[model samples]
Target: MNQYVIRPVRGDEWAKVKELRIVALKDPAASVAFLESVAEAEGRSDAFWQARAEGASHGRAARQFVAEGPGGEWAGSVTVLVEESGTTDIFDQHIERAQGHLVGVFVRPEQRGTGLTEGLFQAALEWCWSLEEPALERVRLFVHGENARAAAFYRRFGFEATGNVVPVPADPSAKELEYAFPRP
Candidate 1:
């Protein structure tokens, strides 16, 4: 929207970062895709939020971007974490390749259908491609198998199903579908 600006999150906007995260956790679709609960996020301390924002905004291995409205209210956000080759992940798997992991994607309900998400992804993927040596080979995201809307959107954006399925650690009965876009 013309009234909004999409850019890298600022270090001092931790409070707003917390607020947007709480709101995102409350979205109906969150239960299937996000691991955090609204109640849990609401319980975090201010210091935790500050640390989180600061790390995400400046961390060399990750980044967080936000869409701020004309009034400086956070409308949505997305974060990307770099997963390098040979590193072992919490999932007990070794990353045999270098890639960017897209996470914490959210767009407020009122901002949906206004092209905010596409713009957000553009900014994120562009940044990922801009990285230096061991340059990103791909950008990947895991979507709940039942999240058809999200899967459709990712498909439209040129990401393809990698046919790799990862079970949710918290809920073994659920599976996450891996999708990836190869760097151009």
Candidate 2:
């Protein structure tokens, strides 16, 4: 219901990607919603952002989608990364199959509940499914156990818990729940 266009981020738009991510990290839920802290992200060099943006821009292994308002404001974003079977995930767990890992999800505070998330997800899913050659069987995401808000949103989008929980990298004593959507 919001007047925004959903599209993929360009390789040259690394600055926008970095800017949006900074905003996301400042959010109240950032501590649980994301694995990186503002300090951690800020410490990275421009080369890191350039590589990230380039990968999402044209690489088959990953893609980032954004909801851009007419006035050039970025309302929201979601990224999908292809995971090959037999590889170790960020959590150091064995990946079971070729899948898409959805991460970096965020929406500007004012843009929440505007259907922007749905738009971003639809784009992310479409890109994931469009990948050929080691086809994806499911799409997955990680949600902090205490972050019921994000978990509920993922559930509404048809992702189900696989009963697998992993320790949070930032706080090993804590946990993050895994949810996934089987490809249709």
Candidate 3:
């Protein structure tokens, strides 16, 4: 049997969503792997999380998938944001094509290296390619240059560095490398 149930998060699971994000922010590599801090996430009101959950749960613009263990524990999560062509991204950068941007990726420490992370990516990428109206051309993700482990994983997962780099907002000295996976 499959070790985990991988599916999009439900709209009503806001509390669990908040809890998992808080946990992710506390991870040892959070400073390099994530853009948000625990303080920033915790300071947000419950209403904000509710809205986020609802939006991701049912929208064509975004989707959040979680891998749950048989014991009902969340093993990891990945969120994909669809960016339409001719629009700017969250960083105010111009997007040349309709595509999926993978973000908010997190897997529990114990779940790492057990193929759980691969499962999460597969689910997210599958969803991205399944969109038809705009017909996604590719899926991309940004990895902090300092985060070597994540960068390696993306490379192994068939995402190639696109020669794009963006300055990390909190620390201008650091950069995030852009990697892309063309639609199959």
Candidate 4:
């Protein structure tokens, strides 16, 4: 069995984070799996990655969970961002409550179905609900309409479709389906 550890990433690990993210963007499923492209991410400055890593480190409102293999390779990663009530989200939608929005989900092809994805999510969700000053009302994620594999995993994990669909800003012809796990 492959051993792995799930934990929060640190500010100095920006290089590895950038490397993994760029690999994710190059994946064949990138168009539907991520909102950003390799060209776009590659164009970003080192300072951007530095801030991204720093902001997503432990104790930050946005946290990135990494699944590290025994060899120190990152098998997968997921990020959860806390959105305060009445604030505008990435899509400019008004958030109705303090909530956790799941994003940047990715796993190495070899790591898929090995429970690494679940481990990454568990860490992210634990951190989300642990917040007290602004208690979270739910955890949510958006899957591309045609991404059945991801949709199935989310459903299996207890997420239910909200019947809410939004146009993918990057591809106006395509849409994204909303899924959520309300605090239980």
**lDDT (10s digit) by residue, model 1, range 23-84:** 89989999886978988899999999998888888756888988888887888899988999
State the weakest 10-residue window (summed lDDT) of model 2: 1-10
Per-candidate Cα lDDT values, in order, are 0.88, 0.92, 0.93, 0.91
- Candidate 4 lDDT over 24-66, as tens digits, reads 9998888998999999999999999998999999664899999
lDDT of 1: 0.88
lDDT of 3 by residue, 1-184 (tens): 1779999999998998999999999999999999999999999999999998998998689999999989988878999999999999977899999999999999999889988889999999999988998899999999999999999999999999999999999898999999999999
Ranking by lDDT: 3, 2, 4, 1
Give TM-scores for every candidate, taking all chains together and pairing residue i with residue i: 0.95, 0.97, 0.98, 0.97
Deviation from native of the Cα of residue 114 in model 1, angstroms: 0.6
- Number of clashing pairs per prediction, in order: 0, 0, 0, 0
- Candidate 1 is scored at a TM of 0.95
Residue 75 in model 1: shift from native, Å? 1.4
lDDT of 2 by residue, 1-64 (tens): 4679999999999899999999999999899999999998888899999999999988788899
